[model samples]
Target: MPLLDATATHPITLPDGTLYRDTVYLKNVISHPRMEIGEYSYFTHCGKPEDTAEILAPYLGHSVRERLVIGKFVQIARGSYFITSSANHPMTGFTTYPFRIFKPETFGYKDLPVKDTVVGHDVWIGHDAAIMPGVQIGAGAIVAAASVVARDVPPYAVVGGNPATVIRMRYSPEIISALLDIAWWDWPVEKIETNLAFLETGDLAALKMA
Candidate 1:
């Protein structure tokens, strides 16, 4: 049997068997490349068209510039925005206005600082949240609603607020370590399916036995 039902029109199966669809409202209106969505990761918009997710500031005409990488089983809620580039104008000059942006001869794309925004496995990014440029979110982190994350978030942390701050760790270090070692997201589909109950119960022994 095929890992994906390719006959579906909207959400297509990615190479890793993840069901993915671009934010339909942004199609043709925006320049985002098709995201490398990991297995079982999906966006929940709560039926609001205005709530959307896209790669921020994709390079003009497929030039391989955007480097946002979201990992397996990442749950991104509606209205979450990932800032992919610094795009800071030459701030050292007298005026902040980007004179270089309009002047082709003066334009220097390389002068601006930009980096990848990487979301690790099993991350939960909340509604209307904004992930700032170069932020690396660790595995199993929970970013609360309306948070603006500007820095790196450690694994299994519960973060909230604008310019997000860590509220607490989800588990003790040992449990978090064990979970990381297990890396359930890397398991085969069949095995994942069979062990679904263990996820709810946090039955590490059962999962290990399987």
Candidate 2:
């Protein structure tokens, strides 16, 4: 049997053989116009499945210009959320407060510079981590628990703390480049399954050959 089922809403089965409903394949649950989610990207949240997109990105409205693009195999732990560019208040004026938001007719911040928030493939975001607007987290990156990521995260880097400084790079630049070239997340499931040993064992030579 295949380990991954793209159609499954509740993908995780606990050791007791009960379905773990808190975890869902994001692509199946999210139907937001401003969001683009890839396959096998699961998010663990206690909220209703229908509200997954809203819960994950509260600031992203249907008419918002900025998008939230999350790539394949992203594992987002419980309470992690993204704050998109739409949430930013205008900074050019004297006050940061949004006066225009109070009135329905006048309510607008459309002129504010908006940039899409992107999460690359095979990324793992730990519990309660918050991704700031316009931040691009690269492939194979790990954002630690309770992090507030305000800047771009490099590929294969482990980051943590407020503003999310890089704790360390998971591999040397050469290896990282090689892995990016391999891009196993883009492979067919059968090919990925066949090469699982190399991936898990960090056998670069074997992976290259595979």
Candidate 3:
């Protein structure tokens, strides 16, 4: 089934097979490209008619694109901000402060390094969360509402605050690694859609047996 419908003039940016469960909604998805949503993900109230996951695509200008690379069973309440190029600034100048003052003309930060932001499966990024550029949220991570994530999160960890810090770990390393190795989420789309019933029952082992 289609995760979200699109207008004839505006197509939803989701890739060929994006599954869903519980409550999931993506209002508009134009300009968003290479989108890959997972199970139980609900993204609502998209910004701008033209804004899309493609917003993450790199460009040569002062402005940067917005990105939201969510994973399976994510509960992103509302107003979660994900910026792909928010990290770069003019590094050549004597002082980085000057670049901020210059606004659009900060030329020194050209070709700034870029890293892909990864959101792990079974993540619960609460409402109004702001995931900074280059942050990789590990699997089963929980980012509390209104928290600002500025660093990498470990698997099954909980983080919250302005510059979110790891307050706790939700699982042992062994289990987390086991789940990662299982990688059920990476299964082919048609297989998932066809075997939806088995998955609903939580018997992922069936995938292994098959």
Count of clashing residue pairs in every prediction? 0, 0, 3
- The C-alpha RMSD in Å for every predicted model, in order, reads 6.1, 0.9, 6.9
What candidate 2 gets wrong by more than 4 Å, as runs, is: none
Query: What's the distance in Å from true for residue 36, model 1?
Result: 3.4
Which candidate number has the best TM-score?
A: 2
User: Which candidate do you rate higher for TM-score, 1 or 2?
Assistant: 2
RMSD of 3: 6.9
Candidate 3: 10-residue stretch with minimal lDDT? 3-12
**lDDT, candidate 1, 125-144, per-residue tens:** 88889888778999999999
Residue 1 Cα positional deviation in candidate 3, in Å, after optimal superposition: 11
Maximum-lDDT candidate? 2
Query: Tens-digit lDDT track for model 3 on 35-128?
Result: 4455455444345434434332233123443344667655566567576655555566575563543565654444556666778776888878
Best-to-worst order by TM-score is 2, 1, 3
User: Which ten-residue region of model 2 has the weakest summed lDDT?
Assistant: 105-114
Measured by TM-score, how close is model 2 to the native structure? 0.98
Residue pairs that clash (backbone atoms under 3 angstroms), model 2? none
CA-lDDT, candidates in order: 0.69, 0.95, 0.61
